[model samples]
Target: MLKNLAHAHTQKFGKGFNVCNLNNMRAFFLAFSIWNALRSKLSWTHYRSFAG
Candidate 1:
């Protein structure tokens, strides 16, 4: 869950989050950033593994 991760990161890092919340609301809880990340996680990981 991005919410839990973001919460943990916010608590750990303390302010200055680069979270840019967009106004495009689709689902009740789905944010634009999170939706994109979840959609691309698999390919992103694959690309990272190959690159690294």
Candidate 2:
């Protein structure tokens, strides 16, 4: 099912809209969620520096 959905999206959108990008997006969201949950565990400045 997921493969079919990806194929359909690629047919409409062309390249750069593939499984690798989808996985990267998933990882980004997962990281964002983890960051949100830990926002208060450390200083905002520390996080900003680490982000850089």
Candidate 3:
């Protein structure tokens, strides 16, 4: 199922649509949403490692 979704994403979005990239994208958005809720003033660079 994940492979199918990744293949579709690759076709639609171009390269770097593998499982790791997909999971990273998900983690980024999840972290972004949480940051928005908390209104963190920290720079993204500072928390980038935590995001991934």
Candidate 4:
């Protein structure tokens, strides 16, 4: 399973593989949203990593 996942990531970033998985896209969007919120001092969703 690890090997398959690694291959998927390699193919995903390689040439001619333009499709991005939904999970990856969601994560990318969420990351940017968090960054923007931090920079703007705006309301932000809770980050579980930092939550008690």
lDDT of 4: 0.48
- Candidate 3 regions with alpha-carbon error over 4 angstroms: 34-47
Query: Model-by-model lDDT, in order?
Result: 0.43, 0.63, 0.76, 0.48
lDDT of 3 at 26: 80
Sliding window of 10 residues with minimal summed lDDT for model 2: 43-52
Q: Comparing 3 and 4 by lDDT, which wins? A: 3
Ranking according to lDDT, highest score first = 3, 2, 4, 1
Each candidate's clash count:
0, 0, 0, 0
Q: Candidate 2 on 1-52: residue-level lDDT in tens?
A: 5567678889998876677666655555555666546656776456545543
lDDT for model 1:
0.43
Better of 2 and 4 by lDDT: 2
Model 3, residue 20: displacement in angstroms? Answer: 0.4
Residue-wise C-alpha lDDT for candidate 1, range 1-52, written one tens digit per residue: 5556556767888754323221112221332334544544466445344333
Q: Which residue pairs of candidate 4 clash?
A: none
CA shift of 41, model 2, Å: 23
Measured by lDDT, the strongest candidate is 3
Alpha-carbon RMSD of each model: 10.5, 7.3, 3.3, 8.7
Q: Give the lowest summed-lDDT range of ten residues in model 4.
A: 43-52
| Reference-based TM-score of each model | 0.30, 0.45, 0.61, 0.26
